[model samples]
Target chain A: GQQVMQIPQYQHVQEGEDFTTYCNSSTTLSNIQWYKQRPGGHPVFLIQLVKSGEVKKQKRLTFQFGEAKKNSSLHITATQTTDVGTYFCAISFGNEKLTFGTGTRLTIIP
Target chain B: DAGITQSPRHKVTETGTPVTLRCHQTENHRYMYWYRQDPGHGLRLIHYSYGVKDTDKGEVSDGYSVSRSKTEDFLLTLESATSSQTSVYFCAIRVTGTETQYFGPGTRLLVL
Candidate 1:
């Protein structure tokens, strides 16, 4: 079994400020995927990172996978109200079965 | 939003009752999964189906069972519902070769 934990259970930032959430796994992971769940909405796929120390960017968002493959991070630059949601990091167990992180709920105040 | 639909968007049941939640997909995906979301536990997988008649238990499979009789449908059943089972349940689908999962609107279940 694999376990993924996320930091800063809840984050509140100004609309123009930057924010970051981290995900750590108890065991080594082959790859990590990120998802975003808006309030009262379903989780939506954002991106996936493979290989050690991989980094990918989606517009204003940046995602990184640690060299050890046991940790990952999602950083948002200049957050906006549309960015308020729960961000989750999911890891697969040698296959397509994904284990999701605890999630970091982000709130942006204008 | 990926042609996924979960029935009875919300449900309220008493303890020791049998409840079944249905997940229907129009995408005809090979992989379908059932997940429960709580306040602090994030999303935990309960069961998943790889094919019409093939299903596997997930990490949180206890007290939950799933059946997939057709390619477009997956059902999650609770033999006897308990209060601890109250949570938001989501259904996700993934294509044969993709790692990304698209989710249904979700079903919120409350067991009293």
Candidate 2:
């Protein structure tokens, strides 16, 4: 069995502040994917990191994978009003299914 | 965006009732999954089907059943629904073996 957890279950920040959420897994993963879910929307795939110590950026959002492939992080710089949503990190170990973390709910203050 | 849709976007039923949720996908992917989302639990996989008539259980499969007789359709059934079964359910299709999944709009069920 595999387990994944995310830190800071809920976070509220000003529009211009920065935000970061950490994800840790009980077992090593073959790859990790990040998803975003708006208030009333479904989860949407954002990015994926397969290699250890890998980092990728999408505009203001940055994703990183640990060297052990058991942890990852997502950082958003200068959050905007539209950034209010829940971010989840999902991990998989060479399986067709993915184990999703508890998720971090972010609220952007306007 | 992947042409995935869930029937009865919102549903409300009483205890001891039978309910079914349908997931339709136009992607024609070989893999389809059903997951439940609650306040603290992110997304727990209930079941998944790799192909027509091929299915497997997941971490939280109890009290839930799934059927995939066709590649484009997957159905989740609850024989005897309870309040605990009230949660938002999502159906996803695997885009690749790498585990990239695209989710449907979601179905919110309320059991009273």
Clashes of each: 0, 0
Instruction: DockQ for every model, please.
Output: 0.87, 0.96
Which lDDT tens digits does candidate 1 get at residues B1-112? 7799999899999999999999999988999999999999999999999999899989899999999999999999999999999999999999668788999999999999
Which TM-score values does chain B get in all models?
Answer: 0.98, 0.97
Which regions of candidate 1 fall more than 4 Å away from where they truly are? none
* Candidate 2 runs further than 4 Å off: none
Per-residue C-alpha lDDT of model 1 across residues A1-110, encoded as one tens digit per residue: 67888999999998999999999987888899999999999999999999899999999999999999999999999999999999999988768699888999999999
Candidate 2 recovers a fraction of native contacts equal to 0.97
- iRMS for model 1? 0.7
In angstroms, give how far residue B67 of model 2 lies from its true place: 0.7
- In angstroms, the error of model 1 at B73 is 0.4
